[model samples]
Target: MKTFISSLLLLFSFNTFAAPKSELWSYWNVSNEKNATTISHQYWQQTLDKYLITRGEFTLFDYAHVTDADERTLNSYLRQMSRIDPREYKKSEQYAYWVNLYNALTVKLILMDYPIESITKLGGLFSFGPWDEEIITVAGKALTLNDIEHRILRPIWNDPRTHYAVNCASLGCPNLQPKAFTARNSDKLLDKAATEFINSDKGVLIKEENVQLSSIYDWFAIDFGSQQQLFEHLKKYRPELKPFKGDIRYDYNWKLNQQ
Candidate 1:
């Protein structure tokens, strides 16, 4: 009787606690190996490459609606992430979680269908749909983007770089970094992203006399420390932009970041 009871308990445990489909992060590992420049770019290139090679559509995976990704695979990845102990997770995981949630949610949105407009268009109850609050089991806790951002990321770490990492799936937002986020590499990745975006024409374009920048700067100026500090950071990469004296302006495109 004891043996049978023990076996039954073990079987029940496995059934109840067996790894789900949302905890695996291996995709990011495969993605990182494909590009050396930065984890952010590697992530983008890998997804794009895979989609282009197999599906012949770069924008197909842009929404969480119509992605070809196996939901079982994604759910498994999320499940593993959920199992990570909060204490064991380093401070950098805060940033990593933000990035992960953003990417995962973005992918989830794209998987639904080829959305023609902005993700915000899914707004409802508050402004966004269930995707906004939809919970995914992570680190043994079921959490939504709101819980990840507000309860975990924002509360644990207050770095301004976070603003750059949580992309809104729009052109005006910072390009989503493409690598699996880690504590050791997050700072470098964030710094690199900020610098690249500020210098990129798509981010902050300084065209001789006319300067056009991402509205992110205007929306989250507080996160960048100050306007001067933000510009200084940008100048570190593009010295040419430093001397350009022109009207500083922001341009925001609501178009979805799909190709």
Candidate 2:
């Protein structure tokens, strides 16, 4: 019975029931001029600086250490983010807004049930992750973490680096950036994030005839295009990765990314 249940959970985790495609919600595909306005992520930045702890390659959030005051501050930041309409801003600002909002909400969700073992354990027996749960309403459109990541960011930006920027609150996922993203620093942060994750063990590790890769590549294979394209993407960040064609495997860790 235990083995059967474990197999079921694995299938659920690996897109048997959760295949989110990069389909744009046309309502949010609009954007204003590049310099039309500026949005500040200072509160989010402050929150990250206070809570993120770097342990080697993994930067964990101090979920256990968050204070009432800090939680209030985070809630306030989230409320402020929800009030604004991102489509009125330029694509760069919108990019930062969506990424920050997704991450902040994820943190908030974790705190709501802290001390949990993994994010996949949320929502009960059949729950794989809280990704599809409707958490907030923006512009009168109810949204989920999946909505933000797959529908808005991925389709609009059409950048594979979107995977690197929007963290999934898991150890195998890319780092929850220590600094909040902004129009001014989004590009640089995205580049740095891509470089870091791709070179790490979670991204790509080649050992003789066997190669292991993060499930991000497998899940979003369309984003990276093809096997050859993925190799180029990995090689762009980690030049030491030599060309190889051999046994390949994909894995992900779903443990809560906390200290």
Candidate 3:
């Protein structure tokens, strides 16, 4: 009976009842030049058309399983990161590494669970959410989300745009760019992310003289340029908004980003 019970427990652990993950590196190709779009506007239209973001969308994840491609891709990226000696990276590679890890691990999390209500829903004690996993082995060392963010991203690359590229799978989160991150165009990609989000109704609010906005601007106000710079940045894309005088309030919907 004890043996049978152990076998049942093992089976349950391996059950196929979990969320589905987003496909990775399938055809995503980020530009290597600054100011060049990470993903073309047309591609954004095509991809989003199929995977529209709606409320209450949930994706369950399996913390235990990973595909060969998933493993290979993450390992490849992380390995490339490891190869850059820290001294050189501070001058060049660190920012790219941080963004790459942020993006790569996000993809890994989606793959493991396939479908989750939101990335934040992966709970744990203290700093041990689903973000804390040794899922990807780099140079034979296991790395988790916390390691990527706290240890790698924050410490090395102090740039504010790091916050924009890492998607937490929420409505309030920045829009996910449909391409891989590389050092070549990191500056441009970050700017685009900032621009797109700032102009988005989801990010900014313009409703009949009553404008509510995303708290992201407040949370990472430092990232949106300076106080006056924020409005200036918006003017480039939303000239009409330049004239609108309305109360600015931030709205953040933390529900899962579902299709």
Candidate 4:
């Protein structure tokens, strides 16, 4: 009976779901830098400037007040993003492009189905989340949020800070910065975002004698390295976490990060 139950549990787990394959990882040469026109993220910056609201360490979007103009501007930005070939630009530019695209697309999806409690509530049957759906086609290949993160950004850059940069439109996730990430300031922006998130309550909690952390660390454990590495990473951002040593728990809030 135990064996049967284990099999059933495995079948139901979202972790068992396979993602669609894409050539994004193999196609781009990260080391090669060719002179090319930089992709402009002006429309994304405008949309963010209009809707993003900062509250302490967390940032929320005024999803309820998103006007028709906002929608148009967001659509224009996505369209513009689709036209560019990531290979032409430098690696930093490509990194910023994918991060901005992932975030902007997330906001677009949330706005499309506004008034939802969480992004996980959207999408069709048996769809654990919208991350697997092909939301955009770039360079003749359809890309999903999962593809952009796992296959492209995370794998290509191998930077754990990438997790802090992409917003999932949830209170549990890191704040979506009010400014679009640019090649010129990607490093500073990523570092600042990591620091902000680590120090925020959403990232870590000390209750009684136990330590609780965001489920992000659990979900992307490989990306952040081992548990000890994660603790070290957290300490690097917030020195206050250094003294906490007890049973570790992880939690995440799926509530829409809205105003």
Candidate 5:
């Protein structure tokens, strides 16, 4: 009986709380055509420029060497972001705002608990990760990392490419770009991110008759629409990647993408 109960608890934590789907936080659905203000991400960019290192297929952040001044810069950027209501800006501008903020918050989270092997370790005995913890307050709402990614960005944007823009601070996730996202260059950034991730073995590796994909597709299957759609999405990035009738596999790395 104890064994069964333990198993149930594990399942409850991993299966129920781990993956959150895209549901529109309807309050953020509004956008302003009048607001053409370009929000500056220079502070966030400065941190990335100073600490992000491109290592082979993925990038690692040097969380250990972050100076006190730079950490203050990160926190200042987060504070500036949280004060503004995204609904007051155009969706294009809002996209970059939310993406940059999400990535910055994730990096800060890892820094708070530096020296950890995996983010899963921060989840304690029964939780999957720190994703559920309210890490930032934005527009008067206390939001979690999951809330930023799954709620605001995913639903408002309705673009699968969004998965590439927000970094999860994991080796298996998309590369954390050296430059912070911006309104003027966000679309281009998305396409570039998709291309880079798709071409890399971490995203898709075609071995003879089999196609191996990152678990992002499997986890966010709803975003990709279907298996056929996923294949099409892959081909969009890598034109040389011909469709195969072989088995498809999904895998991911949960280790902290730390330097």
Candidate 6:
């Protein structure tokens, strides 16, 4: 019947378009906590300083040039990260932890199987990316890169800037900062990262009369509130990018950000 067919079609549409619910992890305040220890990010800092090359607005890792010693250093850093208890840290420290962990794990994943063109090539069964795999364990909870970004950071902070903080190791992503994010400097680092990305050609392209934005704006549109909100967010960072009227399109480059 017409009614039953319509009902089934609507159900199918809903299922297809639905966004998965994210889990909210507990994040404690850091302000006024005098006893909170500074989480050491020296290892990540050293690796990034030695390997990351800044070209214009984006930074690329010297993946091909990495030596066995460098790989061992990265593994040791990840091991140190695994042993830390995130719950004992302040919100600022936890924020840095999750962002650093996500970025490090991504780099490690690529290093495990280097010489790949894109991250999509590392997809698992029934998944288009390596985001769903249990890549790390911290605070006794097994977490994937997706879990760290979505479940822990996004839900806990409800901040759009969080997206800019985690590098996806792709040309299209925000640059992986040359220095590791620290609790003492997280606020300044987040703002600087967002500003740098928004002003870059990779973030927003205005050619002739058309505006092409990074696919990040489209994929995580909800985090940015609405299209108007997204535009406002961009303008907030780069005020000169305003007062233009044009058609908009979204694009992304999945090629490895390697030197």
Candidate 4 has an lDDT of: 0.84
Clashes of each: 43, 0, 17, 0, 0, 0
Position 248, candidate 1: lDDT: 78
TM-score of every prediction relative to native: 0.65, 0.94, 0.58, 0.89, 0.93, 0.87
User: What digit string (tens of lDDT, one per residue) describes model 5 on residues 96-189?
Assistant: 8989998998888888888888776676577877888998887888998888889888887889999998998889899988878888899899
Inter-residue clash pairs, candidate 6:
none
lDDT digits (tens) for residues 68-147 of candidate 2? 99999999998888889888888889999999999999999999988898888766566778888999888878999999
Taking the tens digit of each residue's C-alpha lDDT, what string does model 6 give over 44-147?
Answer: 88899889998877799999988899889899999999998877777778889888888989999999989999776675533455877898888687888878
Model 5, residue 103: what's the lDDT? Answer: 92
* Local distance difference test, candidate 5: 0.87
TM-score of candidate 2 versus the correct structure, residues matched by position: 0.94
Sliding window of 10 residues with minimal summed lDDT for model 3: 20-29
Candidate 1: Cα lDDT at 151: 50
Candidate 4 regions with alpha-carbon error over 4 angstroms: 1-24, 30-32
Residues 84-185, candidate 3: write the lDDT tens digits: 333232333445555655655665565556566556545442221376566565444466665665555644455656666777666677766654455567
User: Which regions in candidate 1 have their CA more than 4 angstroms from the true location?
Assistant: 1-49, 52-69, 125-132, 137-142, 243-246
Highest lDDT among the candidates is held by which one?
2
After superposing candidate 2, which stretches have Cα over 4 Å from the reference? 1-17
The 0-to-1 C-alpha lDDT of every candidate, in the order given, reads 0.55, 0.89, 0.54, 0.84, 0.87, 0.82
